[model samples]
Target: MAASVEHDSLESMEAPQTAVEVEETKTFKDLGVTDVLCEACDQLGWTKPTKIQIEAIPLALQGRDIIGLAETGSGKTGAFALPILNALLETPQRLFALVLTPTRELAFQISEQFEALGSSIGVQCAVIVGGIDSMSQSLALAKKPHIVIATPGRLIDHLENTKGFNLRALKYLVMDEADRILNMDFETEVDKILKVIPRDRKTFLFSATMTKKVQKLQRAALKNPVKCAVSSKYQTVEKLQQYYLFIPSKFKDTYLVYILNELAGNSFMIFCSTCNNTQRTALLLRNLGFTAIPLHGQMSQSKRLGSLNKFKAKARSILLATDVASRGLDIPHVDVVVNFDIPTHSKDYIHRVGRTARAGRSGKAITFVTQYDVELFQRIEHLIGKKLPVFPTQDDEVMMLTERVTEAQRFARMELREHGEKKKRSREDVGDNDDTEGAIGVRNKVAGGKMKKRKGR
Candidate 1:
């Protein structure tokens, strides 16, 4: 009887969470993938491949140039990785594969995936990134890895100075997040790096967003590529519990804290609009006796690395980060995602929430909505083509909301202190200017009055 009541309650929610999209599944062996790869997949507990993987892997193994457009977390990496490994397993010598990513995090991530896929067998992998010494990178390259995963700037740096990168022997090239790496203002660097590579190679491109800039770059990058589109823009995650809390603007943080304390998991991310907002939110969360950390662009490289390490280790339960810092970073065991600040880009919302509900797991995506965030939320909903349901908390959750009120008081005090300091500084500067101007004028007026009094006497 209670289950029926709860089911009705869930159903009444506007954009209720649905089940995952049904896609046809096939085993790796059934897809014509090698037994060695199939064995690894089974070992990893991957019984069957995703739709994108099922379609793209066979085409890739055929040595065909392909353009794969899929949603974030659609297992696109495996689509390319499996085929690359199969091709390289035949000829293990010489650097044969190059994958370009926009960020260093992704470079390391892809390199790790490549290593993992070939761990049963033997596959040599090298990663090119910045903020590290080139000597170490050169050393990694000197061993002549089978696959090289790299960011554009670091690749260019290595090409201009390092001698180990031999593109003539390269047989496969992939631009992961092709729009971010291959086009935009940053694309000039990617274009220059592309010119350094041999054109007679099998090219693979993948990204969440496919703009005209990417299409033009694709023409120049590939030799008549095959296009595959899997997910459309703003596609909703069916297994995710999607809802919003319609609270007053001032009480948003309170309501958010209420939900966070009630949720039954550790290791989650809160999306913020900017680095400052992310930092401020982290500090607020920390003040509430919860383990929270901030991630954003303003943070130093070492700090960002440290934050992610801590997050992965479960040292921090909640990570308050902006979208820019969170991109291309895949963290395991993220239980829930909170949209503290609505994403400026609708696509970013997809990436932010994709952190959870990954690898056949059920997760919840909760958003705190205010008047300020309504339009932005609408944009997100419109893009995803779903109206989310409104969900209110239970009785035990009320205490957490009280704690958030306390936190808001602290935030107000902090803001007031900053405002007071700014006003104090401005008042002091104005006082000094007034004193300087009065000095000469006061003396002249005094002298003239004194002279007039003496003459009258």
Candidate 2:
């Protein structure tokens, strides 16, 4: 925590007017955003710059290797996307811009953002993920898209197996959610992927957490990068109605459904800790009759893509996914975000909540808290240095379930202790219910006449 605070302090001191809070009298046109970009923004109903875009867009356009410390939904995608797209257009080369994400979902999301933003500029964006055809990816590569968004594993496979696909002329190497990609067990794959990219290319790394691993990767991959710390709270939007819950683990799932049903939000996302758990909860939600989508790494890439597309396109509202779904996911219409599983890392909480309260829309983050999750939330609050608001609700079923689970465990332990008190009446009694052979190295008389060695062996 101290190290993170020190880093933030240093970065804050270095940055002047970091975010665009006030209305800019000068248009994006004056800030170097092209006419096509403006037209596209207007078409998409994007009138003003997000705090992240305001700070990052200008810096990236200057051909700098920028290091952004931010979570998902901070508009970092457009921050880099708009500038890099324009930069590429200016050079007008048959080259590609590389974006590396932690998961296939994020890769697709960023690809969509690029295609949406740059399509008006006649810019091309292609996505490369596993479970999709390499032939298709190869064909897309043959088209020579200006930008390529891909997961590390799939990109490595393409580099190794697919012929005539190279990043030799790659201009931009953007690493989204660098903390997850650089911190998780995928470090070896990341090292391999980094080795494949040329040193001459520009690299941009974004993450919520700045662990030592992220620092090491920065030193190794990025060249004296310009670091900016856009804290999670800033990106989450102050307008967001933040709240917390305190209950036992047994009731969290039930309580979540209770509150969500009570609110009846238009759209929502539930961040899960694991894929299997996410699946179960999504199923439970459906049994209760809610429109839910399960997204995780274990799912087929096509399914993951389909689910994300549906969620983003507003086909079905509720989304269930892990941190794997958190990075660079563009869902502009999400009005609510539920923390079904508390984030083990503090930064994840910020990212999870950031999913909502985007595009200047008011939103809410309802965290289903349990005693098990309390510590995690405490750490998160400490990271942000504040407590969250607890939303008022009338749900006591959670308390009943918690009481039942607690009572069951208490009785089970008492039974085990009471069972030990009933002493053995004879030597035979001890062996009566024993799974193991009676006594070590003991002899037993088998029938009335024969003596046998006890098979403790």
**Cα lDDT, all candidates:** 0.72, 0.70
Off by over 4 Å in 2: 1-16, 19-25, 232-236, 395-457
lDDT of 1 by residue, 1-457 (tens): 6544643554354122212212334578766788898888787677878867876786688776888887657788889999988887777757889998876667777888888888988888888876556798899988888889887777777888887566667888898887666433557778787787777888999987788888888888876566666765556567777777777777666776777777746567898886556665665665566777777655544556778889888987888877654556778878788888877777778878888887778788887778877888888888788889887677456644776567655863574345446646655655321111011111111112322353366
lDDT of 1: 0.72
Error of 1 at 274 (Å): 1.6
Q: Candidates' TM-scores?
A: 0.78, 0.77
Off by over 4 Å in 1: 1-25, 182-184, 247-249, 264-267, 300-302, 393-457
The deviation in Å at residue 148 for candidate 1 is: 1.2
Best by lDDT: 1
Candidate 1, after superposition: displacement of residue 370 in Å?
A: 3.4
